[model samples]
Target: MTAERPAVDPRWWGPPIGGVAFALAYPPVDLLPLALVGLWPFLWFLDKELENAPSGSWRGAFAGGYLFGLAQYGALLYWIAGLTGFSVMAVPAYVASVMVMAFNGALTAGGCALGRRFGIPVAVSFPLAWTGVEWLRSFGDLGFTWAVAGDVLANYPLLIQPAELGGVYLLSLWVVALSTAAWRLVRPRSDTPRTATAAMVVVVAAAVPAYGALRLDRLERQLEGWPTLRAAAIQPNVPQDMKWEEAFETEIHRRLSVLTLRVAPREPELVVWPESAVPSWLRYDPRTRALVPALAAQIEAPIFTGTNDADTLTGRSGREAGDYRVYNAAYLVRPDSIVSNRYAKQRLVPVAERVPFVPGMATGFFERLSAWTGQFSRGEEWTTWTVEGFEFGALICYESVFPSVSRALVLEGADFLLNITNDAWFGRTAAPYQHASHLSLRAVEHRVPFLRSANTGISGWVDPLGRWRERTPLYEPATVVADLPIPGGGTPYTRWGDWLPFACVLAWGGLALVGAARARTAPRGRGSVVASSTGR
Candidate 1:
């Protein structure tokens, strides 16, 4: 007799479908409301897996979540393949980034599965589990904080006004809570009535938007009272590969100079350039230094541009001691031919910018990989630069995406923000738009104007209320004369820092402990209790 084939679980299909739902909620698809329904599919799948195979299903649950993450991150980060333009390493880089990010998804699902085993309800377990995992992903050398569920609200400035009070984590919690309500509506797994679910959907749809309208109106009125400064950002549209070639450096300089001169009639108080606008070290390269100051003088405005900087490290011995570390730095050149301040990039992209920590003796291969990119030392502190009586933080490329980095800058008394980046690596993909999404939240959280100057495209200004100005198109050479509305004070997010994530972590931990205690006393058929507790 032929061996019988095992039955395929329909729930197994949940992960990828769920992942795609989440990915579809992001840009290029531009389905803003889909994010609310994104997690429902995965949650249904997890709950089902936990019920049918209640015993020793934690691994299965984790695998399902990981698959879901693979689907989500795979779609969300496919643009990474364009980072190297269809090369041998492109697939691996794309795969590795997705795989690494999937860990957070795995943890979220696995921990929730464990919570189910402990008898914690799905309603309570999933949000706590998911938010906690995001918290964990936000730290350490490999930390990546992009395209979280909360960021769905970034496009709607009014909807994200709550960011000033609780930061994006608060909105993240809000997303999960509403998602749970929606899930219960379709699945009816929980005892929560259709009316209650309908009510929640109503609140988020109608009441929340109403609140956002009121807040936007108030914030706009408030901004009208704030002082404003005209700022110009230069987009050179420099090709990624040719930028590194020795022969092309002079042409690149000429291109930038011409653009700066074009915006000179606008008479901006300050002029900004994209990250590494010049290939050479403006601080040490005598020729480039002379050229930049002259341009600043000609424009009659301080020029803030990204360039390489280096300083020799002297040990306790005072002589040429340890080492001189190269930095990805920013400089503000004055009309008086002076370089006032330098800000080094703190957060570096793993592998692309700097390889992650490995044993000192075993870093040969990684360093070789990073050699073409030329890794730089990490910056130690956040610095704000002042020109024409207006103060702003210089966020170098990856740093602006980080909420903490921007908050720290605002806390340091910055009235406005500047994000300079070379996004040529992203090419003609949704990556530029995805990268810009985080800045909107950052602007709202601190109630300060945020300006982004990218080497390739997706460059624009974000108002304090998180509204975006008309963005420059990709691979286009343009000068954006932006009016920056300067805020006089900081928001609660800037003053208090991220407190919501900590609360979520603590709540998740406590709920897990409660589940453990309940499980110890429950019967052998422990799955029934969890199945019944889905609404808890």
Candidate 2:
């Protein structure tokens, strides 16, 4: 009974290795080309383990993929721990999110194995499976669009300008396709010519940037005469620990007032502050509410700053409303000493603001755990503000990461996008830069000038062509004043949102169905048919 134990599969290490490579492909390391080979180890492991094994070996594919995902997402998102550091539950909550994201990775691997076992080409199958899973990952309350493979290309704007056509997943598809093609060319196979596979990879790599270059040229020239708005985006460098302290409210206001005066010589038409720049709720506090208008009049420029606002809900009867809601709101103060527009944030951060569809989250243990953070009500409208003849959409923190929010604003006549965030919560970490990178794609996708004002740093502006300017350093208290261009017309992406990814999804599903149908029609013990003209 103490006989030899079963031997461990050598391929068990493949996923973790692949995860390391994948993590290296994102920020803090950001080896962009490494993404092309990041999945090679995992894919190679799948091919060797499942190619000739009994049909039941597909289970191993899921296990291996989960391991890879755990390593990949775990390493990629480790910075979340720093952002959630104050809570004792931070580590466990971060670990739980990593575990949930790993399931998507496992699903991708399993689908790839099943497709290949049914005789589909590995090059086609890998991208199809990956893109499908990634598209699904972007949905629902748990959806997190951070650190997708495509985000690696955010630094190379010309290469990713085509996000205007297909959104982020489209770029993910292109990256996975390139990786799969490279894997096919490098590995020995009974199917497909290596030369043909290499040629296809080269074509894809060359064609994407070529298309991007042409598009950038056209858009830049078209935007040459567009109206420009001079803005002073302020970074107060407030510490997260002291941000909401009652003792710091007056001091914080004085700090911002001084910074606004520092940028006064630039004579900006609009002065902007980061999210929740003031500690107190502006609408509820008469002094703070009056402060904005007075400051606007003193500067002789319209000002935009974040605050909390509360509105009482009255029933159909003219009686006092029993219900009240508080919003994470943005206010526009006119130079004429008037508060002109107020826009509430629509997409609040889950659990941090209001839990998703879980009423118990309101008064249960979760509420007690997050009591330090306010439970904010969601805004119902997609609102845009106007200042200095430019119409702009004000996206609160975390909202810029969602493509649909910015797109809807542009479609509704927003000429530019202003993102206000208090990234002090992330502290002196890669989280600020990582968060800023997501906004670049939004700028490209909507063909608008995107301006960002962060509480600490990485504040900047990106033009319609994906060309960026006025970036501030991390943890620095600085005001970036820039003349940002306003978009004159909508891009194709604004006209037809996410249609390209939807089409890719349809094609991928069809191929999977075809492969499944073919597998069922063939003999049970015949095994997978090797197609010589295609790589497995």
Candidate 3:
């Protein structure tokens, strides 16, 4: 017996339409309101695929999913191609990255099909399916946390309060929920009335912002009473190509010194510089070593700056023969001429920073390719730092995209978070602002303030309530000084990490058990019932 597929918008191009719409909801062309219903077309596509399920044509959904992903991630991550001036290698890098994310999209659609086979409603399974894969993509060495859908709402603090409860994944769940509700309202199921669907949407719309307004009001009052710590950030705005050249080194130092001294008048309790602010080994470069500490003494505040550091002064080999382990690190220089602590960036960018774990000749090929993109050893510690009485965690470069990184630091007793990044390579692309948006999610997730210093723009502070305090322009050199209120106590996200995705995985497991039993015991007539109920 063949399963009949719904003839509803079956053209393969439909997924791409959905994908482009979803991409528009994100940065550069950030039509934020589009996020509300962008996924409706995608959901419609998945529902059609579900109609043909159990008979195996449902597997076509995977391809449809990939098409959807290409439209979405391809546009969102196109800035990556601009990384190396859109060079020949950069083109392949961009294509490969999007293909991988598209594959994950295929998996998301396949998941919805699995739910269909088990006779679960599309509404019940689609969000879980989408979120489960999103959770998976954000882990291990292959993690690309930038793919999370909830991140689009970084500016809408109220819409994302669910993040404090479920991390960014919950915000994604919320987005999908709205999309599905919209889908139901437009094309009502046999059981769900259009008016009922409309009313439910209204309630969700009202309640979410209502919850956010209340939270923001309470946090504003508490912030007034809370103890504050004065902090300053330097935006060096160093050009990507010239930053590491010996000729520009002195100029880089001069600019940094000038900016630091400028902020010195503000008397900041602590100061931070963007990632790899000192392209050379800060401790090994004797002249710069003396210079940084002296500058710290001049300001009378501890200075936190990113540096490239090797294991030894003279490049001693590590575990591997004839190989030295270097790190992309953050160092705290105190006015007392003591280096308090150092934290290394754990998450390395794929291909650009570290080669991804692709087996065989591809590994060797990419390793050779990584020559253009120097690979540093991954850091192992979750170390937090203390400056006087204020404690903070330092996130180097793109590490802010990874939720687990900040959560781990907070668990280690960090009261605030700092992100130091060099977005010069992104070069005035939406990438820098997209990179900066992550702080809002991270800050709200743990109820901690996030202070960011970007080398070529987008430097600013995000308060514990997910509000942007001060945002600097791209390609501009500036210094931001502020007395931000510090926060204490753990948020639900900080305390119990990724519980929402885990719950979705468990639900899928439970559904699988039911599907297995039904396959053996249910009659052939039951298949018709499954197909008849599909929609949404």
Expressed as tens digits, the lDDT of each residue in 350-409 for candidate 2 is: 656766565422556656655754478878888887776678888999888777888889
Considering every candidate listed, which one attains the maximal TM-score?
1
Which of the two, 2 or 3, has more lDDT? 3
Which residue segments of model 1 deviate by more than 4 Å? 1-7, 53-56, 85-88, 188-191, 204-207, 321-323, 358-366, 372-374, 518-536
lDDT of 1 by residue, 1-536 (tens): 99876696788888889898888887667687778887878888876877665443789889999999999999999888776652456677788989999986788888877777666666777777788788778788788888777877878776788888778887787787778767877774566678977887678656556767888988778877888999998999999888878899899999999999999998999999999999898978888989999999998999999988887877787887655777889988998899987788988886666667742212467667666444677888789887668778888887876788998888887899999999888777888888888888998889888878899977889888889976898898988988888877888888887788888888878877876676666664535554445433
What global local distance difference test value does model 1 have? Answer: 0.81
Q: Tens-digit lDDT track for model 3 on 144-239?
A: 879588887887777777688889998887787777777777753445676887898888667667878888888888998777889999998888
Q: After superposing candidate 3, which stretches have Cα over 4 Å from the reference?
A: 1-10, 52-56, 86-88, 188-191, 312-321, 358-367, 526-536
TM-score of 3: 0.93
Off by over 4 Å in 2: 1-7, 54-56, 313-323, 359-361, 364-366, 369-374, 523-535
Compared with the true structure, all predictions reach lDDT values of: 0.81, 0.79, 0.81
Pick by TM-score: 1 or 2, better one: 1
Backbone clashes in model 3, listed as residue pairs: none
lDDT of 1 at 16: 85
Ranking by lDDT: 3, 1, 2
What is the TM-score of each predicted model, taking all chains together? 0.93, 0.92, 0.93
**Whole-model lDDT, model 2:** 0.79
